[model samples]
Target: MRPPFPTPTAEDIRLVSAQLGRLARDVIGIPARCVCGAPTVVATAPRLADGTPFPTLYYLTHPAATAAISELEATQVMNEFSQVLAEDEAMQAAYLLAHETYIADRESILLVPELEGISAGGMPVRVKCLHALAGHSLSVGPGINPIGDLALARCSWTPTVCQCLVYDA
Candidate 1:
């Protein structure tokens, strides 16, 4: 089982801010971290402090993971996954359930009327963004997101290993 979600510490916020290249807003918790202790996925508030409706619940914050997923997307992997979604009924059902679970998880934090029923990574129907799916997968752990698990498996990077974690000496 995955560890309990951790409240972001001041140091965590600093690392996340550096990772994002800006100050992150409305981050509720760090749901997934690298073996080296850098945050890979963050559970954000449904609504930002400025009252913007943010639909992405689990945001990928690690630069290496983000870059790896982006590379996967560039290789037309999403198209392949979309085809899989079309051909595999069982996978489709599971992916749809993943979408629903994502929505429910976000709503449990804070309900945003405009953001209801919309999960990130083009879930349920299409494979839009591997980064988002991978983020969701890492946050929730394996088996919950099939396509996400597949994407992560196909990628050069894996959350099980820490690829990048810079510490100040």
Candidate 2:
């Protein structure tokens, strides 16, 4: 579920492609896997093979999980999370650290000047996308991203049991 997660195998790439309905590009590692061994979160290159500045380091690839997170976002929960972030000082600090951590992790792979100081989601000061934040929490394990951890807690899906179903999208 963390750094020890194995590198993406051919089947892993295939599953991720199926999950995304497109080719999984520049996936350096499978950061998190489903209970059935499918990739739930993929650690992609900061830049694409075509040399695009891709800032999203950890991407949620599971259809079920993505749907669940999307559902939460649809409920206008990001506003509530953003409000909470504005009120909680410790959470703000942790979230800033999470932004720094995300940058560090991506920089560890390869430094992209265009992506400097940029982390996925609305981290540090806002909660824009639960998918990106929850993906970050799932990738690094909790405590590093408090809002992410909270989003994961509120979502209906869980990584414990297998949620692998017919991914139509």
Candidate 3:
């Protein structure tokens, strides 16, 4: 059977490693890409080969994108987003739904009992990691993950523009 997402080519993995400055692990597919076709988000296995239950399904791999999101996180924007989630019932419901969607997407690949109900980036209650949330937004597109969408909007990096040294495989 075919995978749910596009399997990464060897060069895609190499680009991700260069972007991360380390080897990318258990990346089953490239779920999101830049307009120039470089991988923006990688779909990883729910459980690693080492028997670890990995909760992060959509991982941001673009260097510029990750760096921008990291800078945003350093600004303590999550506190403000958490406040929004707290004040807006619609935002809370949408975030909760995003959490559920993330879980379902992961379990569609592999069901890891240990990571049950644990979605990345502090979803359903608060915002924590903009990188992870933005990765999700990039993977699934806008409207699904509101905080992720907001993070993407606030960050300087954009997948619409090619910001990589090498985007072609």
Per-residue CA lDDT of candidate 2, range 1-169, in tens? 4443467888888888889999889998998888788889999888899999999988998988899999889989998999889998988899999999988888988899999889989876778888889999999998888988988899889989898975532
> Residue by residue across 35-147, what tens digits does model 1's lDDT show?
88888888888898998999988999998899898888889988889999999999999999999989888887777999977999998898888888999999888889999
lDDT of each: 0.86, 0.87, 0.87
Instruction: After the best TM-score superposition of candidate 2, give how far the Cα of residue 115 lies from its true spot, in angstroms.
Output: 0.7
TM-score of candidate 2 to 2 decimals: 0.94
**CA deviation > 4 Å runs, candidate 1:** 1-4, 167-169
Q: Candidate 3 residues 23-95, lDDT tens each?
A: 8889999988888887888888999999998999999988888889989888888899999999999999999
How close to the true structure is residue 167 of candidate 3, measured as C-alpha lDDT?
37
- In angstroms, the error of model 2 at 42 is 0.5
Model 2 — which ten-residue stretch has the worst lDDT?
Answer: 1-10
TM-score for candidate 3, residues paired by index: 0.94
TM-score, every prediction: 0.93, 0.94, 0.94
87, model 3: CA deviation in Å? 0.4
* Candidate 2: residue 122 Cα off by (Å): 1.0
User: lDDT score of model 1?
Assistant: 0.86
| Candidate 3 global lDDT | 0.87
Q: Which is the better candidate, 1 or 2, if ranked by lDDT?
A: 2
Cα misplacement distance, residue 133 of candidate 1 (Å): 0.4
